[model samples]
Target: MSVSTPSSRPSASSSASPSVADLVAATPADRNRVVDLLRGAAILVVCLGHWLMAGVHVDGAGELRRTGLLGIATWTHPLTWVLQVMPVFFLVGGYANAISWRGARARGTTYGGWLRARLRRLTIPLLPLMLFWAAVAPLASALGVDGGTLRIASMASLVPTWFLAVYLLVVALTPLTLALWERCGWWSVLGGAAVAGLVDLVSVGGDLLAVGFCNYLFVWGTVHQLGYAWRDGALPGAAHRLGLAAVGLVGLLLLVGVGPYGVSMVGVGGHGVDNSYPARVTLLFLGLLQAGVVTALEPALARFAARPRVWAATVLVNARIMTVYLWHLTALGIVVGLSLALGGVGLHLQPGTGTWWATRPLWFAVLAATTALLVTLLGRLEQPAPDPRPAPPAVLPVAALLATCAGLAVMADLGIADADGTVNAWLPWVPLVAAVALGTVRLPAVRRRGDRSAPGGYLAP
Candidate 1:
């Protein structure tokens, strides 16, 4: 196959189907249409995966119960390996950030300016969602919901947030990482991978489990570095993409077969030891596989994405991504709650039963409809505003980024709110919205010529 050099200039071809070249031409010069498509695709896949993986049931007591679908069918662990797309997300994120960061520096955009812009895109639409939960949590508690259930309910709504927290950190560190990449070169990536490998080794060794959490920085940081490699043209052409994919597949086989990691990338039942949660050594390989597949397919996918209908669909999906991701489980919970209250479906089927297997489609359908309603009501905030607005002080943006990370980290440790909706238990919820408001402040708006208000187009989505 011919080497794929993404052209800076749009194609001059007048073909019937809009080519990737035409799509780039239609975009602002700095925008990479391929990266946008990849981000868009990853968002859709993740939302769908969540919907499919949710395991909801009504118990004999008519109370709603929720569990992971993978936990329900342990034998299906291998499927998680295919569906796991977090690696793809970080890979695209790294590539987009590297590109955006370089462009920002060229245009003299400051760390605060670039970061504020990106975080604003992320959190602006999240305000109403946070406020809704805040108000509802107290109300739900007043209605006599149990503390444990309420905690689970609150946490369920925001599980997607842990990812954002980590990603925001990645965004904050991009300037520094790229600078390191320049001097130390690929060694920066090797250093990260070595650390991640060590963390995995130690975690499995039955001691120093707490140290493994560091992979949230190093493992993902390394994957992000791979993105840098892509952005800088260090890994171009069909051969490189294919080779990476081949190696990743081989490495994955060895890791699962010869190493201690499970077959499931998301891990099974009691242990989350795979490519998913804290991330493991296999994720580096998974990143390679995902990035390779995406890169190799870019030439074809770009053309397909360039078609007007396809482009519109992708745009619509991306516009509501944060909303969809944040509210999906809430919708599922609503459905489960209603099902329990209604009782016709309560305790009707057991896990691993033939009847339960037939209902998965129906369960998914209800979730899809409920999520759609929520998105319809809340999606506008997520839409990219056509106008570029003024931004607050550099300190505010920095605070916002760090603040949200803190909130998300706490949420990771605790739920968004506790039973009775105690203010202190949920204090961490404050930053998710506060950060956006700070970053979104209209402070003497400024911009260069040929400016576009495309959010991720500027800082990568």
Candidate 2:
């Protein structure tokens, strides 16, 4: 495929106008809608997978697998083909990064400054939730709660955070990655795919690179380059789109059916290592297929997304996408914790027999209800600051992102320090607490740009 170089001149719409959000807002509807639809799809899939995998309990008396909501963990492996949407997540991410980077360059914002601003939204709210859980786990243990249960809950809460780390790496390298895209064109993406495949082959027993997580570079990096493709219309026209989809689907099918890779996409622990664990080449194929399918249908999707109600809802959610993504896991945890505290939550899983199929409807209702409560209480994070006015360039929200990531990293690294006998386990949580405190105080500076009446005034939601 041929790649069109990024134009140095401002895009047609930008040539006559000057505004940050406006420029971002004015990005072609086709690209914007693609990001929204992909995000919506990714979140939905994640929720589905979580519903199947959270709060699974085993029977104490019977060797048979008793049931919990997470009981499906035993057999949900096959659903990965239908349920895993990681590829799309990265694809949309690439698009967002490309747009943001382009806009930042146009506005003369430094790369570091532009990134810190975007990263703040992604990292801020995570601070409070992480601290709340860190405190809760220790408190519950002290109060005689089952240690195993508390550990499980903590592990589940940290599941989605892997993406945060990988995404940060991608964001931090935006300048270099974009430069590669510009220099090598489509070949850069192909090279990424090749690198991922090579890593998977050499890793063999999952010893190297932590179950192919290293491919976060190659697989995700490849999909991200396609965002550049989307921007340039390099994959334009119906015929080209269809051809790309066909090739991607055919390649993906071969991988699952006869290639060395396994068919499952969610994850299989103790299998030595898993491709899905870190997102490998198989997911790269999915990204290509998803992007092609979305691009081919962009015109139609744009028309549909333009309806007043539909567009309004998208705008509202887009405003809060970070909140929803970060908090959905918290939502499930609340339900699980509540259920456990209330004495018992009925979950009967026959395991391999798949007898729980009928109960799925009820389980889904419980999860939905739990999510609603979580959203209502924590959704405040989704709201724009009362003042829609964007902070000045220098004041953009880097502190929040840097503060939160550092905190989480420190928290995660505590065991290392303790193993070396150099630091206390509890010391790590201190950074986490400090990060959240700083973020809460700094978030107001991250609002959108608009006219302001008073120095610290906010616009009403």
Candidate 3:
């Protein structure tokens, strides 16, 4: 969701890393610092929210048990209104893509070339993660970890892949969506929302859970389209922003208060009716509310982000946001594993109790330290060396994209291992192969004037 500028790339030499001042000075005058700030803030909130909601303890038989605080404490359901910030990320994605695609078109970049560049950045970092889990699953089973515990740990660690799967699809369709936006304008957003509403109604009325998955496109895509509105100055005044907020609030109240959807924005297992997962019309409303509120405050936020120090920090975080998002939960898994190994020494306190609340600072400190260490070790993979290979035939990138999404979807559903801790046969190979195909595909060799084969020839640019 962090749609970064080309300059967000890491320094060429780690030993000569740029200082905060240097980074701030090099920023383009036309850059939108507010979007970067929002993206960074959203990812951090997601990480902290996940850490806060995770409930782990040792059972009577000394086995590690995992639960969710939201499921235990019903009173906290309303808090998801604030914590569910994914809409902001999608909205930002829309704005960034609108700008990126427009510029690419201006420069006469072909669709295949542009898509290949984006896919490389998105899929390359995933290979190491797939490999790490492939090794960990079998090793944990051999060490005698119980199936339930291993499955829970594995799913929690890989949960971020679900987001990647969906976002990658959204990104792949950007060119088409942007064209629709240019032609249809606000109707595009309205049509998307209308379809999403109908899908929810059908799913709820007919008890068709499978039909609900279509909202993955309608809901998020609508929000993404609203981002197009934002970029084009369609929602320009405080009045328009306030009106959006009002409409969203009213819709939310009617849906949750007078209708069937649950109050929690996040999916809590056993809650029966989840507003997430497939996503519901309720999320579209929440997104509208968030979009309205944040855009209304953008003037003030932009001023705040203009400060050199604040902008520098935002830039640094945006540069590695994907890595942080991917690995934060893995850090949590590691901490929980260590605690279990030590006989639940620090995790023994009952969740939602005074003692547990008092220890959260230390708990966060440990998790953050672990996550930082992992990021330090693996962050370099986020910035791969430039792909010198020529772009392949247009069909290859599309095929590669589909394979990557399919692999990620499988991982999201099944995790790296089953409940008995046996690794999924597709664990590493599917995505690993997809990544290789994406990065290594090239045009057939062409003969040069000197009668030598030329290995580098782009499809179009």
Candidate 4:
């Protein structure tokens, strides 16, 4: 929206080369603060969307409103543009990965080990949450709680769960991709776009599953590369950042205006599309728009973050981010379940001619009240710190436990194996995957022995 470019930007990557380590180490706490703010903002956006779509409204006599905007939107469509902050999360994630990887490299850590560590940190605490949920799934189901509600609850959890897997895949590969970005610079990113565009075209005629994964790397990676630019001061000028925003806006318009993309950034249920699906180039465009805004707003964000109180608040939010993310739906489910059990309101709100839209204010109040309670009670899991000392070898024990839990969860979802030793149904591995993936990352510091760095260390600031 702002078109004027500022004077006094730094050199572009093409004109100058900085070691990745230098880039990582040079990232200011102010810059990290901006990222934290963005991340916190993303969580809030998601929560708002959930809050808007969620509810338990009782009429004068206490009955569920059958037809309402909230009901229609909740099951079919989400507040897409608002909820689309998911891309922002991933884009910032890219930046985080770049900084962390560069820092690990500087500290002489192997790429694999560095990646593994990142994975562990991102995922470890998720284990207890998963086990808790898994242990409860059957209990809730067996209690004759509404099966439909259970399914909806389970499905809602799946949306965020995929991100953990997708992000792992992205972080694991950043070393190689960033290397290309270093060598070919912008062209490397362009190459990725070209591939994604072509794949999208092909998907018009045939299945695009394999081709779509290209986006998970390219679109997200390009946004991550923006972090490198931010660190290097390549985007120092306001004009350039604004230009990025313009490009993103244009991208969004093109996708929504002419393309097969929906205006709702998040997935629309009955309308089709797991919009979060990489197949749609619209998401890439959204990432562009988000990255653009973040870069442009960085200076102001930096200034805002300068306040110690603000920074402390942001740090507190950052500490709870994962917990908040993993448990948000649980919070929603709690509200929904409790409200239903209380027999205060049926699951659905009173549906009038867009009447739920009018009741949104009320729905938001309840969502906020319940979410606060859930966060206060369940947010502790996200605050775990990696163990500084080397842990005694427990590979066998750990693996066995993981296996036991995973098997139990899966078996619960799908009755025991068939007589032919065939598992009849595909059990959701997300909870298990979340545990193992995160647990692996949380393993104690196994410094390559030749090198010593702080535990949970990234590149020096």
Best-fitting candidate, scored by lDDT: 3
lDDT, candidate 4, 1-461, per-residue tens: 01111121112332222222333333344355677778877887777765554433555655433222333555434346556776787667766766677776786766545644554455654555566555666677667644545555554443455555556556666788778777887676567667766767776447756676566556666666665556556666878878877887898777667776666666544443344555366677666677777788877997897686676666556656776776676666677668778775534545433765676677667766775676677654442333443332334224423443454334433332333333222343454553445445334454333122121222221
Say which prediction, candidate 2 or candidate 4, comes out ahead on TM-score: 2
Q: In candidate 2, what residue range of length 10 has the lowest lDDT sum?
A: 452-461
Stretches of model 3 off by over 4 angstroms after superposition:
1-22, 270-272, 440-461
Top candidate, metric TM-score: 3
Off by over 4 Å in 2: 1-31, 58-78, 205-211, 269-273, 348-355, 383-461
**What C-alpha lDDT, on a 0 to 100 scale, does residue 280 get in candidate 1?**
80
lDDT of 1 by residue, 291-329 (tens): 788888877987887687776666566556788877887
Question: How would you encode candidate 3's per-residue C-alpha lDDT over 1-461 as one tens digit per residue?
Answer: 22334464334453233433445555667777788889988998999888888887776788777768898888889899889998998998898888878878887877777788777677767777888887887788788878788888888888888888888888878999999999999889888889999999999889999999888888988888878888888899989988898888899999999898889999886664789977999999999999999999989999999987788788667656777888899899999889888887887777888888899889889988998888788765554445555656657677778887887777777777776567674665777787665553222243223211111111001
Q: Candidate 3, TM-score vs. the true structure?
A: 0.90
lDDT of 2 by residue, 1-461 (tens): 11112332124344222222332343343345646755765786787776665535445542212233322354555566667777777776776677777777887877546654555446555655666665665566667755555545555655666667667667766778888888988888888888888887776544575647678677877888887777666887988888778877888888877766665665655432355666778888877887788788888877887676665556445544555666676566676677666654554354334566667677778877776666556555443233333443433334544445554544433321233223233633643554445333345456444312111100110
Worst 10 residues of 3 by lDDT: 452-461
Which is the winner by TM-score between candidate 2 and candidate 3?
3
- Model 1 lDDT, full chain set: 0.69
Q: Which ten residues in a row have the lowest lDDT in candidate 4?
A: 1-10
Per-model TM-score versus the true fold: 0.83, 0.76, 0.90, 0.74
Ranking by lDDT: 3, 1, 2, 4
- What is every candidate's alpha-carbon RMSD to the true fold? 5.9, 7.6, 5.2, 9.9
